[model samples]
Target: MAKDLQERNHLVRWGILIGLSFFSLATIFILIIDFEILRNPDITQDHHFRIALFILVIYFTIYATSGFIRYLARYLNNRYLTRFTALPKLSSYQESFTRSYFPNKPYEHIVILLHGFTASPQEFQFLIKHLEANNIPYISPKIIGFGISSTHLLSLAHRHDWYRVAIEKYDLASSLANKVSIVGHSMGGILATFVAMHRPVHQLILSGPGLHSAPSDLKYKRLLSLPIISSLYIRIVPYLPKPIRKGRQTTSDTLDQTHTGTMFQYLAIPINCVKEVFSAQDDVDITKTQSDQLTIVYGKHDLTVNMSALFQQLDHHNTPYNKMSFNNSAHNVLEDYDKEYCCQYIINLLKNPQKTNPISKLKKQSTTQVQADA
Candidate 1:
């Protein structure tokens, strides 16, 4: 499967290169032919042709230079820059606390809820309540380097750290219940995938999983992978500010309209944290995924991660997963516009693992349909 994916990637690259070469050749031919028809004394002396060639040369030079710099930055970041750490002294905050719901009696199944990077367990507030109402047991724990007042820890924590926390939680859940199910959103989705692969998970529910990043984020991640570039870039700007406190009515007010802005989230995100997320995504293997054990929920308008690429990957691997989508929701479908519908969808999945509901009737869509939705 890996080889097949690699070959497909190579074919795509070659196709792009060949198409560009043909276009360039066609343009050059047209320029020369037009110049001769116009009775130009000499091709070399034609200012119009010289100007066009000059512009094309400059464009290619910039493109080549940028590619070289990107690779150089990645090399330096991997070789030496990884040693640097910017972790902060994380203190316990009320909003960042772990949420665990255990029924009075013994529960047969346990659900592990994992939040996105830089987000807190608060994102699962609605789902938590629904689970409680249904007498379902769940554990929503905060991952390291997130859900805190500072974001510096995100820069220091590697993908392994995040995976360790997930594993620990899964082991604990395994001991407590006979069956385990993991529900992860965003970056947490990737961690859930890792845990599901190694542990005995009964169900794997991923919401807007960060299997592949959006186009803009992909470029930024590639740029930051270069060691020298990452080091120098951090020196200039260590963190990117976030609008966590935006639209707050007062100093003590927490945004109550949604699950967002209800926690002590970081005011800024460490620039280096992008690399950690990229590494986290590397652990996910669509080919290894069991379609029968998977339930996917994603927003059609999600801009944080590349939904199109993710759907394409799953389809390519012939993974016919149970999928649900919201037209209005984005990356935070759990807490976004379709919070109620999303939470209910999850509740139904958990309550009826052995049965399919009307909403889940479309167990899976064809590749063409998935791409069109994306």
Candidate 2:
């Protein structure tokens, strides 16, 4: 299956390259013909060629303008962020530090929180409060590249570094507590799976896992997954605008509107960083995963991951897992619209690890809904 996926990805990459090559060649040929027509007024009678040239020129104009804006945005962002790159003290960035919460009672059970890509431990702030109030011991570790202002450092870090840091944090939690559960969001969900594969996890809760990207992100995913094309592509355009929320839905609930403190990369992210995410995801095989220890919490409005593809993979693997869905939430389920219900649901699961039926513990909400099986 892995080999087949790889072959398909290769074909997609080559197809994209071929399509772009043909478009470029056609544009050049049209330009040459137009120049000849201008030099010889009698040849200007070719109306079909003139129409084609006009269309291609308009397309090129839009593409070039978009590319220029992306490159300029990357340049300014990098220049601003480079100031923090030299700072020896990570403490300067409060969000960058790993957060650990040890209750008054001795640690019998502990939960490890992993934040998503381009996001910090701050994403779990509300959830952390709930965990603390309930006297639940938890540790939220900051991934190596995240929580810092420097996109350059983020680009430098690879998937291996992310996997290593997560495993180390898991090992630390294992030493402190008899039982440990992993609660991961987005990219963290991917890391959590890898950690579970390496060690024994009491429970695994994934919030909008990055196993499969949304339909909108599929083109970018395919383009960046290629080795040679991605490397060259990044050099030309290092960053692109991050997808924005449509309708009235907003991320204001998840992040503070007044605070300049960077909890998430709202503007844009390095293309190389995106490539690293795809690399980590490629290492994960859903068929080999142990679904018995897994529970998925996702949002119906999520645009970051393809829910249809995720469901297909789960059903095909016959991976039995407790699935919860929130209509009001997007990718950030922790502090999204259904946050109150989401946090309570997670707290109940952590408190009663033995209870496999998630629906039985939490009261069903009319506004938000849950699906029992995957």
Candidate 3:
């Protein structure tokens, strides 16, 4: 009976895979035909042969590549899940305290590092090393739907669900330290902001918070709100052939190889969730809130979040904060640039709490001071 059950499960898995493969192929065919015949009116009878040849080549390439990509993604995802799920021996220092500042004295503050979308706790491994050296108690939990977190009931609409999850985890971390400082990267930054708004955090550090919206945002919003359209699109588009060369390297690629492999594995997440998290704007009025303790950090060359726009929004909102930009860094500020510098920046914020807004500080120290005095 057990063997029979196992066989049935195997059959089910294969059936799903086969169905998806067929669906993708059909979607590609329809899209290519639709684009060629309906969208392009410039193609005349004289150029039909050339256009047809070009389309065929593009379609075949995309079709073959998509299948290969999906297969690899699935294979890697299974391997990752299996490795993480396996029980391992506990560390000898599981509960042991390391004293750095003073001999036999434990650290007082705890730093909670939150990684961004499609990322795992592994991304913060470097940051963890720095924390250990400083003897700072830190916990980096993989948000649900990412890393080792269960993905059974995961969906794109539930992206903001991390806010509640972070709160629950924060409560657990509070037992370890008198004060908790949260450092969030990308979407994790937005989640951190949600938590900070509700909780009494000592300090809030937002690193490339995924708050900005682009043209694609409008498309997602429309698709997510219309159930019929979204369902049809998902079923058809996943199989359809898209130009792989035109595909941009999203923030997901900047992650460590292992983490990137893990993320691509579960590309089955609902597109709605992706839309909700990426397109959803922060509704909280930072200026009106009494939570004045906040710090914003971003990389100068970040391709994900618009640093300038974010800075402008923060200033317009009159949110009390400090802005720090890493000169040679990308979206993953802590990992991409100097890990030690990022770590030390957090340490400085903890040691000396700055009250003045970062923009105000700059204004106060402007070169006009010398001219005004003259």
Candidate 4:
């Protein structure tokens, strides 16, 4: 038994050493690319070169230390060394649902669903299932800050930068789909509006949408601006000991069940990104301007968004929009409530163009007056 124990210990030590070495090599490779080591010829006696070397060394030390500490923490906290794992494969139901519902229709209309902050495309899985059932082809791209996408925007400095990239990519993707409709929830809704104003999309749907900073929003903005406070807050927010953030809690009453083995991707979105998005003044007036269609859907029990503020903004914009509300749903109305109804509504819009009038009422009135005068 003593010999067997010694052999196991030897294997564990080797494994940790191997893991640390691999991490160091990967870090070095990334640093080389970031510094453009191969392309830059004037490295000798250059201050930039020296700065890069110093930064690389600091990064290497920090990363190496982190890896070692993490490995030690795992061993000390648990008896077994946990192996790195991949994301879960799509289940039989999910596979069949994807194949059946998202059939490659001549790719006429593209429906882009942008999830809320700290959420992945997984949040829209239920909605996707329903869209598939209705044979509506859709693209649920994981925004830069979430899912498999890069988390560089999660930092306080680049927080809103993700939206610009997201919009550009979304427009490119939509051009292939012919007509595009943007659907966003929470902060994503704010982005959807920004896209609607700038990018050429067929329609817009805002669900429990996030809006620009008001006097009230400044309080949260100030909190996020503090460097140390924001970093610490973000690190702990994902793994909060309680089920809620601040006083805000999901209305689901049931114990906040966590999906095990799921990864929470980090993003470094900054306040400037938010400011830039909010500060943009579009030439198009939503109320006076007619688009394909604009719909704002909210849940009566939504915990994240202030409904009154959202309505006021829409009203001020003079955007010709319809408001739909779910009775007892939270922020995730498409998943927690009537997803089928939402999917069908989207389908009906795609099939019947007349449902969403593109021409302004002012134009119609002018034409009518001209005919009467003639």
Query: Highest lDDT: which candidate?
Result: 2
Model 3 lDDT per residue over 173-254, tens place: 6666678888888878777776676677887888888767444345655665676887777666532221111133533424
Better of 2 and 3 by TM-score: 2
Candidate 3 Cα errors over 4 Å, as ranges: 1-107, 149-153, 214-218, 225-228, 235-269, 279-292, 355-374
lDDT of 4 by residue, 125-217 (tens): 666775786776777776654564543444332333445545655655565676878777766776676666566767777777766343445
After superposing candidate 2 on the true structure, give the runs of residues whose Cα lies further than 4 Å from its correct spot: 1-106, 245-263, 290-292, 354-374
lDDT of 4 at 110: 70
Encode model 2's per-residue lDDT on 159-185: one tens digit a residue. Answer: 877887887798789778988899999
lDDT of 1 at 169: 92
Best model number under TM-score: 2
Q: Write the per-residue lDDT of candidate 1 for residues 140-221, one digit (tens) a residue.
A: 9889888776666777887777877887798778767878899999888988888876676788899988889878667767
Model 1: colliding residue pairs:
73-226, 73-227, 74-225, 74-226, 76-227, 77-227
How much is 138 displaced in model 4, in angstroms? 1.6
Report the CA-based lDDT of candidate 2 relative to the real structure.
Answer: 0.74
Tell me, what's the RMSD of every candidate?
17.8, 14.6, 14.3, 18.6
